[model samples]
Target chain A: MINTILCIILAILMISIGGKRGIKSFISLCLNFILLIFTFYLIACGFNSVIVTLLGTIMFSYFILFYVNGRNIKTKISFVSVIIVLILLTFFISLITYISKISGFGEESLEEINMFSYNVNINMTNITVSLILISLIGAIVDASIAISSALYEVYENNPNLNRYELFISGMNIGKSILGTTTNTLLFAYLAEFMTLIVWFNGLNSSFSYIINSKVFASEFIKIILVNIGSITIIPITAILTANKLKNTKE
Target chain B: MSKFSIQRKDIVIFTIILILSTISLVFVNNNFKFYTSTIVKINSIEEEKIDPITEPNILGIEEDYYLQKITGTIMNGKDKGKIISLENERSTSNVVDEKYKKGDYVFVSGNDITGLKRDVYIIIVIVIFIFLLFIIGKFKGLLSIVSVVFNTIIFCIGIKLYTNGLNIILLILIESIIFTIISLILTNGVNKNTLSAIISVIASMLVLSIMILLIAGITKYKNVNFNGMSFLTVPPEAIFTAELLIGGLGAIMDVCITITSSIKELIDKDNNIETRALIKSSRNIGKDIMGTMINVLFFTYLSGCLPIFVLSLRNGVSLTNYIQANFSLELTRFLVGSIGIVLAIPISSLISIKFYKRGDAR
Candidate 1:
């Protein structure tokens, strides 16, 4: 009941304050939500989880960049950077998920699932990769777009700046945003598991045990990986945006 | 020549980080004896399928599953250097269990496989993250790392206090204040810009809290599901509210800092700039950040809930039940945090306007 009220309030707030762009953002958000649902439904219906996730993430980036923010030199460059980062991080995420064997539900959730059938015929490891990818796309898209647009503005104001200067300026802008971006990722991820941490505390779990525990390991790994994605995108976007902008001028 | 020198410095930093990461990775992988849990390295595994759906179930969705006879050598504990054999069973789904392979490390006690050894993989990722921070941010990266550590310590302290019977709402209020001060000061330093960001963050958070309170009062906290936290002994609503407070802090801080810093830049560029221009530019900056900032919040929260949502749906959970039992809390969280993000824009702009005028009045 309260959820409806909150949604209504949020929609009203966004549309009223944000105007046309706000309405576009709202639509994109709703579409993204529907896309996620459709992706999961496909995965449950026995499609390859990773492939579906890859396609879903692409659509997500497209919606966020083109549909919501619109296409331009900045969005184009950002979309390229986001894809590059996604590809690179995919390998890392898959490698870590496989090697760490942190796939599947944590032991703490074991009790909760006792009522459900376990023979769902899906590779939980692949699902882990998918979730990590989805968790990461938002911050990476945000950071890359921020860099590309900010750098575009620099290029607009002072067309004489070379690729190196633009690249450095992009890096500087990245530095200013990096701290708060990391904080955003950290706090957001950690907030999701506040209850679990409290549960650990209540159980008087030792520090070493908590760190090594499957549930804590999974959540902590996701947090670090997301932070890594957001961080690495900065330099990559800076370089890519610089080279792209510089070459176009000639 | 200067650009080349900058590139040289970057390469030097990259090399140092690369060497450090490799060393750390090697050290962590071999440090099994450091753990108190009995660790075993699987040497081989033999698997056989258990067929014939003998027992009927509600879902009636049975498939070929595996039963494994796993043999391994103990890497740690008193049974070190001894061979051990254990039996494991896994569904093809493997939702809560994993199939063990050769060269894998598993935690064991006697004959039962307890868990997997995962600390080494975690160490690898953390080292790489720190390396990137240093490579990109240089000294500020190091300071941000320090702030992260300090903030984590503060978090542990907060958890400790919560377990020791402190009021969670009050505790979180204090913690958020400390978090803002420490984070802004450490990353941004103590200056008017940082000061204004801090003021804006706290003020916006206060306004958000009041707004949430009013809404919760109107609705009487109805339909806010705490089923996801059934293990809690304390009031789940208080924890939920506290989570809402900290959840919004990051984006709020991002929006506040971006606006204030942009305003500060404009003021520094033209000290004689009029309030109208300042407001205009600040709103433009806010507009640029607002969409992405909200997207960041949306996706971050949604990721955590996706797996559970999928899992429940696959297991024949009705959509309404899933929404009531699991997603309501998530929706509330996302909505409230986003509202905080949006609210921060104008509040920070207004506060920043006043802040600059008072400090720079001549």
Candidate 2:
């Protein structure tokens, strides 16, 4: 309660100083709060991993991308592509979970869970996959948006351009964005856990196992999925949606 | 007469596929966590030298480090804030941080910018600068500020309400709505434009939500492993179904804003633009945005997980242990959020199309 009051006061103060930007910041704060709750709700419901994963993703799309703002292709496309990726990425997750057998967060987590009286299915491998995937979601979306917007702006400016021309334009834009976008995700992942990565370096571990092992392999698969999901969908979805919407008008 | 109508068959087919995918995701996710063993290790002993500069942190970072010259405020340590020398650490660097001294008051943790040998302040000064910039930007900044703070509070309270155990879907549904309203109100202001955007975002979020739940149920992925998440507070990713929840949160907002803004802009561009033409044009816009939007999520999630992989290359954590001890949060964030980004593209486009066409036909 006190924190809420403080938040309110601070928000008002920011509004006085910054106005619109301050308002945005304040909204971000609230949206994050609701997102946090939705997360908990999933956990509280006996660990239904699949449901939670899906719920979390949609909630993220709604809050982070749209903030339920005005109608724009920017928001709509993001939601659609994100959901589709959610469905498609399952293949990699399943494969990772199957090989890891580190279900319910490995032996350490299982031991703890055994002590509890919860009915939730605690699969460490699956749960860990969730975290890895979540982290990648942000950069992937950002990159996708940047590419799509750049392409459409081009097409909008040059409506006389042929479909082939438009697609080429999109690919050209996509290529430039791709390099940094990939780096962005890669760096973001590394930065967030640089210390832990450093810790892993000091540990007595193997290269082959690190690459092929469930943890490494799973994350590897996830990163690949995110990369592919973001980069792949941007052009294809953009083109198709553009084409369909275009054909309809003509 | 029914010229604007979507083909019933197409809608049915799309809906079926969506529902099926949702079911599949659930089944796959539930029973698939009992296999892999791998851990990426790290080893390092290199130091790079950069110019020394005093940095400060006030907000928007992982660790608890704020701006203060401790000359008068150092509770325990000796070299409080007295012209301390900066150290040379890692990825972080020292830049002119005027906000701490000039403005208000921030950490990535450790002496990333400063060395450990001498007292060093962890640098989230960049983030603090960002916060200061927000305060300086005024109204627009205030709106953003409102969003940041507002979202944080909603997240916390929502967590409590969920823990106390409310109707699960209701918690999500209500929060989504409130989130939409607040976001629009804050960013676009109280107007017709804001109202329209709010509606589109809500609609798009809802459809995507249905797809996610459907897939989770079908896939039956067991979501266990909720403990000892390495983070500043609680690893929201690991708590509850955090991976999916937070994973999808940012993307949802991204899509909502895009779709609404595009539609509003198109409508504003030419109020007489026919409904069909408006939808098509915006969708073309969506295509461009979708590509980049998807990548945004990719970077956000994948970047968060990169450190482990890099460290693995540097040191030698066992593959088995690396995946086991780590990799949960990062991987999930990527996949789920990516999925949401994909789904959002079509849903928002479709809704917006219907919306503008309605206005045009009238």
Highest TM-score against the true fold, candidate: 1
**Candidate 1 chain A minimal-lDDT segment of 10 residues:** A112-121
**Model 1: fnat (fraction of native contacts):** 0.54
List model 2 lDDT by residue over A6-77, tens digit each.
234445543543345445644654565456435534433336545675677667666666653334775566
Which stretches of model 1 miss by more than 4 angstroms? B1-27, B52-59, B217-220, B318-321
In candidate 1, the residue pairs with backbone N, CA or C atoms under 3 Å apart (3 or more residues apart, or in different chains) clash, namely none
- lDDT over C-alpha atoms for residue B174 of model 2: 76
* Prediction-by-prediction clash tally: 0, 267
DockQ of model 2 vs. true complex: 0.06
For each candidate, report its DockQ versus the true two-chain complex: 0.59, 0.06
Candidate topping DockQ: 1
lDDT of each: 0.82, 0.45
